[model samples]
Target: MLATIERVLILDRAEEISKMVLQSEIAEEYFRCIYKVKNNLETQRKIREFIKVKEQYEEVQRFGKYHPDYRVVMIKVRELKREMDLDEHVAKFRIAENELQSLLDEISVIIGHSVSEQIKVPTGNPFFDSSSNCGGGCGSGGSCGCSA
Candidate 1:
């Protein structure tokens, strides 16, 4: 019973700390950027189009390299992605998201290392290698093979 109470207290304190971090100036800016993109009709339309094109690209890929339309589909997908990246709102949102992710990753690494040390495990390469490996559900389409 006492252990359960202690666990609840720890969880409550962790949630409080998380709330504090979210209320920080940088976090506020991140949220503002995300909200701006989310609320913009134009951005939403472009994102929808981008998702459609990405899905088409994936479908083409499943046809394998021998498919006659594979090359054409690939080219089209690249062009669509380029146009999406050029959108001011999308680009800004991506930048803000990356910044927020970096902060979270740093926090995760610190905690991971601390836990690893406590368990007598080596803390080499704290985070999983995100390069050349599909971290899964990348949402970027398979254009970047990291999610492949």
Candidate 2:
């Protein structure tokens, strides 16, 4: 399985590669952490795929029993276990937790950085203004206030 390299800095054109690459450095540690995670997933997927590729690998030993990607991926896996003091296959779970938070943070930052007000008008009825509906769900046929 091919590893998906997430683009940290959104780019529009070819000229933006410099900016993307530059901003990528600001999140160097972030990207490094993400890469380790993505590579780990790829490694696990490859392990499953290896059952199919095993014959090809055997016939063509240019990459040997262990592909170069396997070593880097395995090293990251080992590093994660040692760093987190995790046992056996539990590191994958921990990495998912960390990566999920990192992903959420990155997305929040992106959204916060480029925020725009969305105008949601109630269809073509301009008279029925949402701003005027201040009674919460009461305006939508749901109870918001209690009977005294």
How do all models score by TM-score?
0.68, 0.22
**Model 2 CA lDDT for position 87:** 33
Per model, how many backbone clashes are there?
A: 3, 0
Predicted model with the maximum TM-score: 1
C-alpha lDDT of all candidate models, in order: 0.70, 0.44
Give the alpha carbon lDDT tens digit for every residue of 1-148 in model 1. Answer: 4679879997997798699779877689888888888898987887888888788788878878877878888887788788878888889878877777777766655655566522222222334333214443456777765424
What is model 1's C-alpha RMSD?
A: 9.3
Give candidate 2's error at residue 96 in angstroms. Answer: 1.4
TM-score of 2: 0.22
